[model samples]
Target: MQQKQTPSALDRLKELLARAGFDWFLGALIGMILLAYLWPAPGVQEGPLSLGELANYGVSLIFFFYGLRLSPEKLQAGLSSWRLHLVVQFSTFLLFPLLALPWHALFKGGSNELLWLGTFYLAALPSTVSSSVVMVSIAGGNIPAAIFNASISSLIGIFVTPLWMGLFLSASTEGFDIWQVMGKLVLQVLLPVVLGIVLHRYWGAFAEKHRQKLRYFDQSIILLIVYTSFCESFARNMFRGYSIPDLLLLGLTMICLFFLVYGIIHLISRMLGFKREDRITALFCGSKKSLVHGTVMSKVLFPDANMVGIMLLPIMIYHALQLLAASVIAQSMARKAGVAAEGE
Candidate 1:
C-alpha cells in the first residue's frame, strides 16, 4: 500500500500566510515612508480634505457592516455577562489609559508630545475583530462572546476614542478644534457605518464571497492614509534629530505595553472567576486594538499635528508585532492545553 504523503514546510508556511492576511502592509508602509521621505508634500492645498472625508465614510461603513452582521440576541446575551464585559472594558479603557499616563510622563519631552498622544490613542482604541475572534477560537474561548465583544468594542471605539483624544489633546496640542474633529467623525465614520449596515443586504454576499480579495481593500485604505500622513510628516521634517535608538526604545516601550495589558487582563479574568474559555476571550479581546480606527481618526483628530505621524510610528510597529506575537502565543497555548489533556 502506498503511504500518505506529509505536507512539507512550504505547505505549512502557505497556510500561515493565508490565515494571517499577510500582505504588503509592511512593504507598503515602508514604500510609503520612502515616498514621503523622497517627495515630501506639506504644501498640498487642502480642499475640504475629501480623502479624510472618504475615510470617515469608510470607517463608518466598516462599523456599519459589523453592526449589521452582529446578532442582536447575541449582543443582549453578551451584555448580560456583566462580569465579563467589565473585565474586558476595564482592561481596554481604564487600564491602558492609566499605564499610558506614566509612559507619557516619562517621554513627555521635545517633540514627543505626539508620542504621548499615540500612547493615549492606544489606550483609547477598541479590540480588533478578526484577530480577536481567531485567537478566541484558537484558545477555545467563548466564540460567540468573542464576536460580540470584538464587534461592540469597535463600535464603542468610534465615540470613545475621539472623546478621549478631546480631553487629552486639548491640553497639549495646538490648532485643532476638538468639536470639529468630532463632527468630522460623526459625519464620516458614524454616518457611513450606518449606511453600510443598511446596505449590507445588497453587498453582504459579495463581501462574503470575495472576502479574501476585499481584505486588500482594508489594507489599501490604511496604506493610503499612512502614505499621506507620513508625506505630511516628511514635508514638515518631523523626523529631524531622531535616532535609531529612538526606534529601539519605542519598540521596547510597545512590547512592555502589550505584555502589561495582556497580564493585567489575564489576572483580572482569573480573579473574577472566569472559566477557561471566557478568560481567553478576555485576555485577547481586551488587550488588542484596531488599526482601522487609529489611521482613519488620526487624519481628523490630529490633522494639524505634523508630529502625529511619528506618534503613529510605535503603534504601527506594535500592530505588526502583536499579530506575530499573539499568533505564537495562541499556538503555544493550544499545544500546552493538548499536552495537559494527554498528561491527565
Candidate 2:
C-alpha cells in the first residue's frame, strides 16, 4: 500500500502560500495599477478597451468553489445559536446604514458624490463568509453562529441593498427597479454559489487539488473589478473632489466606526450574559464589513450609477484595516489568555 508523504518544510511553505488570502488581494491591486499605468483603457464617454472586459468566464468558477465548501453540516450547526446570529446580522445590515447618514449629509453637493455614494454602499453590504469564519475560529469564537449569520447575511443583502440604494440615494436613485436588482444578484452571486455547493460532493477532490489556484483566481477577479472600476472613476474624474486631507479624515472616521461598534457589541454581549466563546464570535463577526459583496454587488446593483469606485471606498478601506486591526487585537487577547492559562 502507498502512503502519503508527510509535509516537509518546503511543502509547508507552499501550503502557506496556498492559504495566503486577503494580502494577495492587495498585491492584485498593485498589478492592476501597473496595468492601468502601462496601458490605459478608453472610457465609454471617451472610448473603449481602455479597461478590459476584466473577468471572462472565471467568476463562475469562483462561485463554484464557495458552494463546494459550504458543508451541509455547517449549515445545520450554524443555526443552533440563533441569538448570536441575530446580533451579527443586526450589526451588519442595521447599524452601518444609520451611521452613514450623517456622513452623507456632510458631503452632499460636493464633487465627492462618488465618495459619499461609496459610504452608502458600504452601509448596505453583507457580512463576509470566509474571512469572518476564519477570524472567529482563530479568536476561539462561536463558529456555527458565525457561519450561520454570515451565510444568511449574503442571502438577505440581495433584497436589502437595492432598497437602500433607491431610498437613501434618492437624488440619482430615480427609476431604480428593485426586481431587476434581485435578478442580477440571483444570477451572478446567489445562483452561482448554490450551484457550486450542490456539486461539492462530486467535485470536492478537484476543488481541494486547486484550492490555492482558485484563491488566486478569486483575488485576480476582485483586482480586475477594482481596477476596471477605479479606471472608470479616474476616467470620469470622480476623484477630483477630495484632497489628501479628505483621505486622512476618512481613515479617522473608519477608526471611530470600528471601535464604536466593537464597544457596543461588547456591552451587549455582557448584558446578554453570553459565554466567552459566544462573546468572541459576536465581537469579530459583528464588527466586519464585507468587501466581496460590496465589489460584486456594485457592478450588478448599480449597473448605470456613476462613481462606484469612490462609493465603495469606505468599505474597501474598512475591510483591509479591520483585518489588520482585528488581527492585532485577536493576537493580543490570545497572548493574554495564554498567560492566564499558565497561571491557572
Candidate 3:
C-alpha cells in the first residue's frame, strides 16, 4: 500500500495564513502604502474622477452591501442573549475609551501626540463585524451573539464615535460643528445602509452568493482610501518628522492595547460566569476595533485628508496585530474544544 503524503511546511504556513486572513490582499495593503509614498500625485490631486470622490462613493457602496447581507432573523434571534450583548457593547464603547484616556494623557504633550490621537480614535471606533465573527466561529464561540454584537456595534459607532471625538476636537478647533458632522454621516453612511436593508429583501441572497467577490471589492475600496490619504500626507510632508523608532513604538503600543482590552474582557466574562462559548464571543467581539469604520469615518470626521494618514496609523496597526493575536487564540480554543469533545 502507498503511504499518505504529509503537507509540506510551506503549504502549512499558507494554510494557516489563509485561515487567519493574511492573504495576498495584505500584500496589496502594503503595496498601496508604498504606492502612496512613491507616486503620491494622482491619488492626492483634486479633480473629478479623483481618488477622493471615488473613495467617498466606495464608502457608501461598502455599507450598502453590508446592509444587504445582514440577516434580520439572525439579529432577532440574538436579542435573547441580552447579558452577553450588554457586556460586549459596554466593553467596546465604554471600557475601551476609559482605558485609552491614560494613554492620551501620557502622549498629549509629547512628540507622539498625533499617534496617541490615532490610538484614541481606534478606541472610539466599533468592533469589526466580519473578522470578529469569523474569529468567534473559528474558536467555537456563540456565532449568533457574535454576529448581533458586531453588527450592532457598527451602527452604534456611527453616532458614538463622532460624539466622542467632538468632545476633544471641538474644544481644540474653532468652527468645528459636531452636529454638521453627524448630519454628513447620516447622508453618507446611514442612508446607504438603510437603502441596502430595504433592497436586501430582493438582493440579499444574491449578495450572499457573491460574498467573497464583494469582500474583495470592500478591501479594494479601503486600500484606495488608504492610498489617497497617505498620498495627501506625503505631498504635504506631514510624515517628515517621524523616524523608525517612532513606528516601532506605535506598533508595540497597539499590541499592548489589544492584550489589555482582551484580558479585561476575559476576566469580566469569567466573573459574570459566562459559558465557554459566550465568553469567547464576548472576548473576541468586545476587544476588537473596526478598521473599516475607522477609514471610512475618518474621511467624514476629519476635514483634512493630509492629517488623516497620521490618524489612521494606530487603527491600521491594531487591525494587523489583533488579527494575528486572535488567530492564534482562536486556533488554541478550537483545539481544546476538539480534545474535550473527543474525551467525552
Best candidate (score: TM-score): 3
Q: Write the per-residue lDDT of candidate 3 for residues 1-344, one digit (tens) a residue.
A: 99999987567545655765667876787888899999999987887788899999999999999999988888898999999999999999999888888767777767778787788889999999988888899889999999999999998999999998897778765656899999989999999888888898899999999999998899989999999999999999988888999999899988998998899898999999999999999999999999889999998998767788999999988888898888878877887899999999
Two-way lDDT contest, 1 vs 2, winner? 1
Instruction: State TM-scores per candidate.
Output: 0.88, 0.86, 0.96
Tens digits of per-residue lDDT for model 2, 251-322: 777878888888988998999999988998888888887787777677777655346667767887888677
Score each candidate by Cα lDDT. 0.73, 0.72, 0.89
What candidate 3 gets wrong by more than 4 Å, as runs, is 6-16
C-alpha positional error of residue 279 in candidate 3 after TM-score superposition, expressed in Å:
0.6
**Model 3 pairs whose backbones collide:** none
Output the better candidate (1/3) by lDDT. Answer: 3
Q: Model 1 shows how many backbone clashes?
A: 3
Q: Which wins on TM-score, candidate 1 or candidate 3?
A: 3
Ranking by lDDT: 3, 1, 2
Candidate 2 runs further than 4 Å off: 1-22, 34-38, 42-57
TM-score, prediction 1: 0.88
Name model 1 segments beyond 4 Å from true.
1-14, 41-68, 71-74, 200-203, 341-344
Positional deviation of residue 62's Cα in model 2 after best superposition, in angstroms: 2.7
